[model samples]
Target: MIRLSQDNAKSLLAIHGWSGALLGLLLYAVILTGVIAVFADEIGGWSSPLQHEPATALPKGLGAKLAELSTQVDEQYHDDLFFFPQAGGRIRTFFHKDIVVDGQPSAEGVEFDLDPNTLAVLDRREGISETIQQRNTAGALSAFLVDLHVRLHVPNPWGLLLTGALGLAMMVAAVSGLIVHRHLLRELFTIRCRRQDLLAKRDAHVIAGTWNLPFAFILAFTGSFFSFASTVGIPVVAMVAFGGDQERLIETLVGVSPAEDKTPKPLADLDAMLADAHARVGVEPSFVSIAHYGRADARVNVFTPPSEGHVSSNNLVYDGATGAFMHQKPGLGLVPSAGGVLFDLMGPLHFGNFAGVLSKAIWFALGFAACYVTLTGMLLWATRRAESQAWQRLARATIWVGYGLPLSLAASPIGFFIGRSLGIVELHDSMAIAFLSAAALAGALALSLRDLESLRRVLLAATGAVLLSLPLLRLATGGPGWASAFASGLQAVFSLDLAMLVGGALCVFAARRPNARLAAAARSGIEDNQSQPA
Candidate 1:
């Protein structure tokens, strides 16, 4: 256990509580969304399952299809090409070139979504990357959730910076929590049911917070790295190392700046390269990116998922002009290095996907516990100052967000289904409207209801009802039923449907069986600060 001076311990306690209370709501939002995003791939598949699952991510004739599509677009687009399986077994192919847009280098591209089985084009979009992204329909819901977690729906660099700072704050809070709770190991399993309501709540918070401190630190550190790497780290590195030439910096890092050979060359067969990569790596390729496509110096990079019993994956580089295997490398560099190993570890450490579904589920559970600890800690802090009107108002706000955000999240998918059914092109806006409307309704209920218990029940019931209807909504929106989905190898859709039903049932059950002490605490103003227009 850590030993600190009395004054230092007190200071650390203040730091921990304030750090969490100041941005607790926003931090909760990020953590909750991130928990869901751990299943982003499953969510995408569940939202938009194909009629027939593909045997492989890239079909047999992918190379030929890519060639045909390449001929249709302008030559400038041949500078960079990317292919990956997107939502609903659709293979997305993007052909783009870097160009100056508003004094910044941006990708202008034509993107195609192709049916994986037939290799037939399903959708076509042409624009700068950002605008094209806004038009994507297949992965709309998952993208929306991810964007919320990463940026809080704020715009680029500013959003990243804000989230990065939040990450640092979380780290500080976690460290301070460890310091303040001197008996951290003992508290990890300590809970006194007979204690005062406030004491019990505090003990519960400490228990969860103590158990979650290390995980929280890891998440915060890695999350901050991701947010800052592109937004700040890369810019600073480029300024110092490449004299602000981002392109040169990228080339150096990727280890692929072969002398330009722009002469028209028929690109080597990608299928052959993919087959070779699979044979060598013993895993399916997850993504393929081509640089200088159709040129003599073109290079293809095939990124594979981690092989069984592996913690990290490898990338297979090939000569795009000759279809010859070049070399296998770690993600960060052409050769393995300390930096590359560390860089490669960040993704799996943050995402917890290295072990697939089991790891993701464990991460989700831990993340949910972290959210609970944060919300409860904030509520306890606000209730301690209940004599102040501002504190009471904060209590109401806490109730509105803590119970309401889940309901709002559950409602957003309703909008996704509604917009899809109505053939609306941009479902993101529809989702935003639904989310905001639910939050408004939640706020209204929080204000009108005289007790926290009533407000909590109403929101929980609403969330349950919405979640229970989501499967039906999926069916109504042209998604396959569970039986058909199961028969057709769409286990993601079937499993998600069952998971939603189970989640909805649990929410309803919890709402019906409110905790006795918590209910009494709500009645005594410990939960809602007397609930009088606050």
Candidate 2:
């Protein structure tokens, strides 16, 4: 156990509480979205399924189809080409050229969405990479959720920096929590239901936080690394090492910059190379990129998600002209290095995709507990200061966000399904509008409601009702029934449907009891605060 002087302990306790209450609001948002995003692939699959289930991700004759699609785009975009399967088994390909935008490396190009079974072009868009990414429909809901989690729907560099700072804040909170809790191991099992309302809630919060410490640290560290590596870390290193040329630094870190081989060479059989990669790695490649396409020096990079028993994904290289297997390339530099290993490990560690569904489930549970710790921390802090009107307002705001967020999230897919059913293109905007509208409505109810527990109950029930309606929405939008989905190998659709049902039932059950602690002081003030409008 960590031992500190009483003064030191009190000081740390103050810092931990205020920091968590201030930063924990946004941190809670990130963690909640992240917990949901652990099932993003499943969510995507359930959202935008194709007409037929395909046997493989990299469909046959894609090379020829890509060659045909290449003719439609400008020659400059031929310099870089990549294709990957969206969660719904749709193949999305980007034919683009690298360009620096806003002093950072970006892509300006055209993208195509193809049917995995028939190779039919489903949609096409041309623009900067970020804009086009936002317009994607195949995985629209999951993509939006992930974007919210990663950057809270903000633009790059700034968004990344914000989340990275949040990650550092989380690390500090976890560390201080460990120290201030003192007997974390003992607290893990010492929740006292018979104590005062505030103390019981505090015990529950401490217990959850203690159980989540290790995973919280891992998530924070890796989240910080991922958020900063591209935005701050890479830029600083490039400014120092290559005189501020990011493109040059990227090429150098990628191993070797072979001499310009613009000499024309018909690209080799990409299908064979992809098949070879699957055979050798024993896992499907998540993404395939061909650099210097149609040139003698073109190299194909196949990146696979972590195989069984591994934390990091693997990348295989092949000759783009000859289709010959070259080598299994590391993420950075030619030889195995500490940086590459760290880079690779960070992804699986932060995202928990290493062991597929099992690991993702574990991450989701831990993340949910972390969210609980954050919320209860805020409540405990505000509850202590509840005698002050200002603190009462904070408590109300916390109640609004903590309860209202899930309601808003549950309302989003309603928009997604409605937009798709209406044949609307660019579904993200509609979904965002739905999310914001739900939030606004929740806020209004929170202000108008007379009691904090009443506000929680209303939002929780609303969330439950929306979640309960989702499966019906899916079916109304042409989605297969559970029996049909299971028969056709679309298990994700059925599984997620069942999950929503269970979640909705649980939410409704919880709302009926309204066990959330609102603190005696805050509970007392709610009558007057409701009259005062704030």
Candidate 3:
């Protein structure tokens, strides 16, 4: 319905094409990894679940355990405390105070891993938050996937910068694509399959890109905000208003300015507060945080995941001393504002975890479509300029990354299952090594095979083979069998196992298509039996 001048349309088309051409592969990788990460919690549960889930997300008698542990740590460490479950439903409790470590604000604390049922301290570590976090075995595979999607496994500010740039590129492509497709209505339904190969490809890309335009923009904007918030947003705010005191800036945002009242008070029963939180919201909190633990003015924040029919998570406040109900705070800032509400919306929108599995599955499908659009768009662009060496190289890379990434990803779980079963502590290293090794192998396979379709077939087949074996690998490496998983209500394990089998079969099936075409061509003597190079 909207119109642009010819020159404007041409300019937008150029922008749309070039933006995707230049950065499409990386965008595809990010989006694909993001799709995988949608099931991170599920994957974590499937990969490293306990015999069964805890009776409750947060069990009873935790308050007593915390009080007992509190006496062992320094009093200053009681300034803040938080507990959350990870990796097989084990509870991790950290009693810590925020402090500057190497000119960067970091948490220094004593963290204890507790057996959720027995409330027994399984292990304890004390150090800076970042270093201590590295020792955790929680959600090893899921964490790896998230780290790749978030930062591409690169280090800090640089990694954030790279991802943020990709986000901006995606936004540009989405916006320009929307503007340049003048006959958007017709384009959505038109598929010129009987026409030129290139036209058909364009139609496919247009249909997908148009359908996914809104989600593309939403993910890109929110991802950019998340990536830049730590690297650029916070520091700018700190410099402008807080005299560069990052800690103060955080405190201001959290709305926790309190008169220091250090008189020791018996900590309220956390079990009661946790149960109360579930009753209030009809869901268990993701984690519980107590500020100024053991102090008179201590406040507890019960942070819950998204409830049904909600787009954002909730935080319910409680009186730490008496376990009394406090107000539910909606915004991050001390005062409710539009900016805070927008910020709150970002996580649920970008990650699509608001409504749990159903929402995540829809997000996964949309992300897959986005990946298809990105990769196909790149291929189409390269095809138009295939005479040039550079474009040819880009085309080859597009094929490799598009097909080979899943292959590399399939190899990571090999390390995790093997390491966990073998009682090896270096599970993350094992995973990284396995993934990189597969990438190298896939690269070699791509280079050795000049035929792009042939390369894709090989990679996809290999990935399928790996996926097919993963469930068995888990079983071999001490994972529960389907019957056991079912008996114990470990639906995640059973579901993932069935999914892998079906996915593997599909991959193997899809990878055989080119071969079928080749076989028919040979039967008719239309082509030689030997494979041709690209």
Best by TM-score: 1
TM-score, candidate number 2: 0.94
Per-residue lDDT tens digits of candidate 3, residues 230-343?
999999999999999988999988865668888999788888998898899888888989999998989999999867777768899998888899888875787678987887
Q: Give the winner by TM-score: 2 or 3.
A: 2
Q: For candidate 2, what is the lDDT? A: 0.86
Give the whole-model CA lDDT for all candidates, comma-separated: 0.86, 0.86, 0.84
TM-score of each: 0.95, 0.94, 0.92
Off by over 4 Å in 3: 72-74, 240-248, 515-534
Q: Once superposed on the true structure, which residue ranges of model 2 sit more than 4 Å away at CA? A: 101-104, 241-245, 516-534
In the range 1-534, model 1's lDDT, one tens digit per residue, is: 889998888788789889988898888888888898899989999998888888999867899899999988998899999999988879989999988777656899899999998998989999998778878888899899889999999987889898898899899988888888887779889887896666677788889988888889989999999999998998899999989997788877786578988888988988899999999978989899999888899999999988888878879889999999978877785677899888988899899899989999999999998899888888777777667779767777887898899998888888899998999877899999999999999999999997776788888888898899999999998989878898889978989999999999999998897666555554455444444211
For 339-449, candidate 2 gives per-residue lDDT tens digits of 888878888899898888998999999999999988888877876766788877887888899989999889989889999888877898889999999999999998999
